[model samples]
Target: MAEIEHPKPFADWETRAYWEGCGRGEIVLQRCGACSKVQHRPRALCASCLSGDIEHFVASGRGQVYTFTVTLQNNAPGFREACPYVLAYVELEEGPRLLTNVVGCAPDAVSIGMPVVADFTAPDRDLAVPRFRPA
Candidate 1:
């Protein structure tokens, strides 16, 4: 079996809340205090209003698959064994589209609008990757 290559937080102050929320089994999204719009890919300022007044909020961990693909080729050595996996863009309940892996179903069975819920695994690691399963 190939070694598991996990995701770690970016070395930036603005991303601290996101990683910390994950450690606590929470899904955090950035909300613009000015425009009141929620977004992902954590940053200091809101993408819409460019306002530095932003706050962190936890999501419901429920979403629907906006799009997805079945990856049959894993070029990376660590992920080679997990090939033929499903990578999806899930439109979270809080409004941000998140890139995540869709598990608990056949790779070929994944489809648009399929409901999914967040599942946290191995939180003790330096990095905790959020996974999803059919709701």
Candidate 2:
């Protein structure tokens, strides 16, 4: 299989814990203390209740493929080499959906409602990215 070069992810004050958790081979999410809602794309406040009481925790890294597309063409640097890759929205067991690549299988083998587990890329880098594969 061809290796896909993953660019480094950016981290800010509000998202530092998330990036750090990824580096440790974990998926981090935030929960609102007020509304008891879980969310992704780490933020300083809750998107549901707009409350400042937010807490971070490691996620199960398991989910189902909500939707997906097989990319047979791309001219970008890293993606060009990774033609025929599967990009999908994985609905986490925790509630939020993440836009990520689904690897470790053929593109045609991926389908909606398929079970998957998180996989990390660039673990040696400052931040790792979460990809998904068949569980």
User: Who wins the lDDT comparison?
Assistant: 2
Clashing residue pairs found in predicted model 2: none
User: Alpha-carbon error at 132 in model 2, in Å?
Assistant: 0.7
Query: What lDDT tens digits, residue by residue, belong to model 2 across residues 1-135?
Result: 466776778889999999889889899999999999998889999998899999998999999999999988878888889887888999999989999999999889999999999998867666788899999
Q: How high is each candidate's TM-score?
A: 0.89, 0.94
For each candidate, the alpha-carbon lDDT, in order, equals: 0.82, 0.90
- Show how many residue pairs clash in every candidate, following the order shown: 0, 0
Return the lDDT, model 2, position 26: 91
Cα lDDT tens digits for candidate 1, 1-135: 232465455536888788777777788898898999998999989999899999998999999999999878877765677877888999998888899989887888889999999876667654456778899
Error of 1 at 116 (Å): 0.1
* Model 2 vs. true fold: TM: 0.94
